[model samples]
Target: MTAVKFLSDEYLDELGDLVTPDLPEVPHVNVRLQFHATDTPEGEVDYHLVAERGVVVRAGRGLLADSDLAIRASYRDLLAFESGELHAATAFVTGQFAVTGDRAKVLDLMVVLQSGNYQRFIADLWARTTW
Candidate 1:
C-alpha cells in the first residue's frame, strides 16, 4: 500500500477511521486534545480529537472549541514521537512538547495513551505515513 503524506486529508481520514476501533474504553480519559505541529514542509498542521468514555467521538483539522488539552510542538519533534524515535513523555519532559491543560486531565488521558492499543495505533500510523 502506498503511504499518505503526513497530516494530509487522506491521513486525517485514516486517523478518523482508526479512532473508533483502536481507542480503548477508559471513561476517565475523556478529553478534547488539540495538536499543533508547526514548521512542517507544508507549513503548520493542526488537528483535534474529542474523546468521551475513552472513544474518540470527533477528529478533524484545526482546533476544537473547548479542548481539555492543547499540545504544541515542532513538526520534526512530533514526527519523531510518532515514528518511535522519541517517546511522548520524553518529549514532554525535555520541553520539546508543550502542553497546556489541567494536570489531572493529563493523568487521565495518559492511561489511554499508554495502553497497548495506543501503541498499536501508533504502529498503524507509522505504517501508513510517508516520511
Candidate 2:
C-alpha cells in the first residue's frame, strides 16, 4: 500500500472548506498549526491559514500572527486522521493531537466536522491523501 502524506497546504485548504459553511460571519480569523514530528528527528513546521467571510484568503507564511486557534500534531497522525483511518476523538484520546487558543473555535470546528458535510470533507481528504 502507498503511504499517505498530508501537505500543510492541502490540509489547510480542506479544513477551510470544511468549516467555511458553518462558521459565523466574522471578519476573519487566522489559525496556525505547529506540526511536530514525534517519530522523526526533524523539529517542527509551522503552517498558517486565514479564513475570511467563509473563504480561505491566505495560507502558509502569508497568514497573520494573531490566530483564533492553534493546533499541534504529527504529520503522520494528521494524515491518518484526515484520511478517516483515525478518528479525531480517538486521536485526541491517544495524545496524537493537541489544540490550543480559542477552545470555542475548536469546538465549533469540531461541530462542523461532525455535521453531515463531513462526508465531503472526507472525500476531499481522500483525494489529497492519494495525490
Candidate 3:
C-alpha cells in the first residue's frame, strides 16, 4: 500500500472520515491522535486528529485544548497499523507506539478500528483512493 503524506490535509480528511462516523457511542468521549515523524522536510512534526462522540470535531496540524485520550505513534507505524501490516497489540506491546489517557476509550477506539466491518470499509476506501 502506498503511504499517504502524513502531514497532508488530504490525508487528514481521509482519516477523519475513517474515524469520526464510527466511534463508539460513549458519552463525552474525546480522542486526540498525534502523528510524529522525525525525518520530514520540516523537521520533526506532529499532526493532529481530534474526535468527540463519534464525530470528527477537528483534524489538521495542531493539538486540541483537551482530550480524553491521546494516541501517539510514528508516521510509518501508524500507516502500518492502518493498513493491517502491523497489529496494534503488537505495536503497543513492542513499544512501537504509545497511548495516554482513558484506557477504556482507547480500547474502544481499538475495537472500532479492528472490527471486521471497519476493515472492509477501509479496504474499500483504499481501493478507491491513491492514498
What C-alpha lDDT, on a 0 to 100 scale, does residue 70 get in candidate 2? 69
lDDT of 1 by residue, 7-125 (tens): 77777776776566454477566878889989987788888877777766778677787888888999889888878898777887888989998656666666656677667876887
Order candidates by lDDT, high to low: 1, 3, 2
Model 1's TM-score against the true structure: 0.87
**Candidate whose lDDT is highest:** 1
lDDT of 2 by residue, 1-131 (tens): 23334554444455455544454543433333333334422335566555444334445423346777766787678667767788877876676788767766654455434544456756755775652
TM per candidate comes to 0.87, 0.56, 0.63
Global CA lDDT of candidate 1, please? 0.77
Alpha-carbon runs more than 4 Å astray in model 2: 1-5, 8-43, 48-64
Off by over 4 Å in 1: 21-24
Clashes of each: 0, 0, 0
After superposition, the stretches of candidate 3 with alpha carbons farther than 4 Å from their true spots are: 1-7, 19-34, 37-45, 48-61, 128-131
Assess candidate 2 and give its lDDT: 0.55
- Lowest lDDT sum, 10 consecutive residues, model 1, at 18-27
